[model samples]
Target: MKKTLGIIGGMGPEASEVFYLKLTQATKAEKDQDHLNILLWSHADIPDRTASIEAGKTEELWAIMAKDVQMLKDCGCDYLAVPCNTSHVFQDRFNTMMGGHFISMIDEAAACAKTVGTTIGVLGTDGTRMNDLYGKALRRNGCTCVYPDKEDQEGVMHIIYDQIKKGQRGDLSLFLNICSHMKAKGCDAVILACTELSVLKNNYAELSDPWYLDAMDALVKTCVTTCGGIYQGNL
Candidate 1:
């Protein structure tokens, strides 16, 4: 039987949309019924995750997410995927709160990276960087993780918030520069740890330098596999 995939999304609405689209693109469906069942709760009004974490107060954010998880469960979702990277810091708590229905995008991404190489570069928000969500998970799977310098990390934030999240076409040059820096640092591949950064995959076909493993893409694959569907590969 096919399982229903629940998405606790809208950390930034654009990223969630991309994730949903990826899920559709990744599935090998010849008919509408062949596609996996997806239930997306795009609560765009939820508090900013990075801001709450930086402020040292995650309780409100956790409460909102936990409530959403319960709602998805009540709606008959069999499995869950969260598109946001910073939100993965609350995976353990949310799992417990939701009685373990939550799927860890961080873990999925780490597992994917493990198959590719042992050394990876991470690109995301300040909260994701400070939390080391990707680093710790990848390390557990025997992969070493590297990150861009402070200045470059700021550039990443600018692209995510100032550009992508705001619905502007982000400057690909900024991303290329950071990927180049990570390559110079001996990273085998770079993980687009932030869902907001996942939007860059659209421009990836144009460049061939830094190989990227997108977290949202990993989550889409996980959703398909968990739902007993085959991933049709990247579009």
Candidate 2:
């Protein structure tokens, strides 16, 4: 039996699109309806996760995302997923709204990172960093989380929110530099906790000895499993 996949998206419109496309390819169904049943709410008006985190605007952001989740629930979605890593800020809020069983990219990524090794570096927006969503999940799974320096994290935020999420892609040198530093810091792996990092994966041939974990890839894999789809990714 096939299940419907409801997406709480538009945190960054590009990641929402990427999630849809990846889910389609993963499902491998010929026709549109044959593909995974997806209900997407691409509400670009949702407040920025980075800004909300840095400026302590959590209530405003979650309120917007909560409405989206409720709409998906009202639409009769069987399960809910948010493609944005930072939007997981509202996990607790969504849990309270949806009864506490939402599929989480943070947990999925943490489990995947454990398979790769125990110590990992996290690259995400300010909200994700400040809130320690990924870091907390990693700790729960017997993994240690290393963070980029303050300036490096700021750089990552700019690249993701200011650049890639807006569909402008260039200047990956800073990201590469961070990867090198993580590897040097003895990280066994690194989780790209921001879904927008999906656009930056092809720039290098494996930046370091430490494995690279893409949170978007983890979400796609979850979708594949829930919808009986085929997933092809080495992360």
Candidate 3:
């Protein structure tokens, strides 16, 4: 029997769409009935993850997310997943509060990063960096987490905010340049730690250069398998 899966989405709508698409892509189903049960709560007004994290006002985040979880449970979801990476800063507390139903994207990404390299480069939003979300977990897994330098990081943010999130084509050269800089700095692989950056993998073919691993893809795999669906490995 497949367990119902619930998603706490809409931290950024595009990313959540990608998460849903990839979930279907990752599931090895011959027909519609073969797929796992999934419920997505994409509340349009869900608080901005970065803003709340930066302001250190995570209680509001907990309130909104917890309400969504309860709503999903009322609808019969057995396990929950939050596709947003920065949201994992509350994984520990939320797991404790919510009875450990949430599947963690950060831990899944860190595990994927471990398999990819001993020194991994991470690209994500400022809130994730501020909380050391991926960094701490990667370190715990014995992998060195490498981040972009100040200027390169700002460029990455521009691509995330001014480009993908806004439905524009991010500068391909700029993104590759950041990957090159990380590689030159000794990163065996780079993790696309932001969901918006994961959106880039569809636009830029070079993003599939084997030098990159998408955190969103990692979550899709874990979520699929955990929900009793066979992983299709399509990502």
Candidate 3: which stretches are off by over 4 Å? none
Per-candidate Cα lDDT values, in order, are 0.85, 0.79, 0.86
lDDT of model 1 at position 66? 84
Question: What's the lDDT for residue 210 in model 1?
Answer: 37
Stretches of candidate 2 off by over 4 Å are 30-34, 202-210, 230-235
**Clashes (N, CA, C under 3 Å) per candidate:** 0, 0, 0
lDDT of 1 by residue, 60-162 (tens): 8888888898898899988888899999889898678656767898998898888888989999999898999998999999999998998899999999999
TM-score of each: 0.95, 0.90, 0.95
Which of 2 and 3 is ahead in lDDT? Answer: 3
Order of models, best TM-score first? 3, 1, 2
Candidate 1 lDDT trough over 10 residues, lowest sum:
201-210
CA error at residue 197 for candidate 3, angstroms: 0.5
TM-score of 3: 0.95
Clashing pairs in 3: none
- C-alpha RMSD in Å of predicted model 3 compared with the true structure: 1.4
Tens digit per residue, CA lDDT, model 3, 1-235: 8999988888688889989999988899989978889999887587778889888888988888778778988898888888888888878865765578778888888888887679999999988988888889999999999999999999998999899888886889999999889999999898898889988887778777767889888889988998999998844
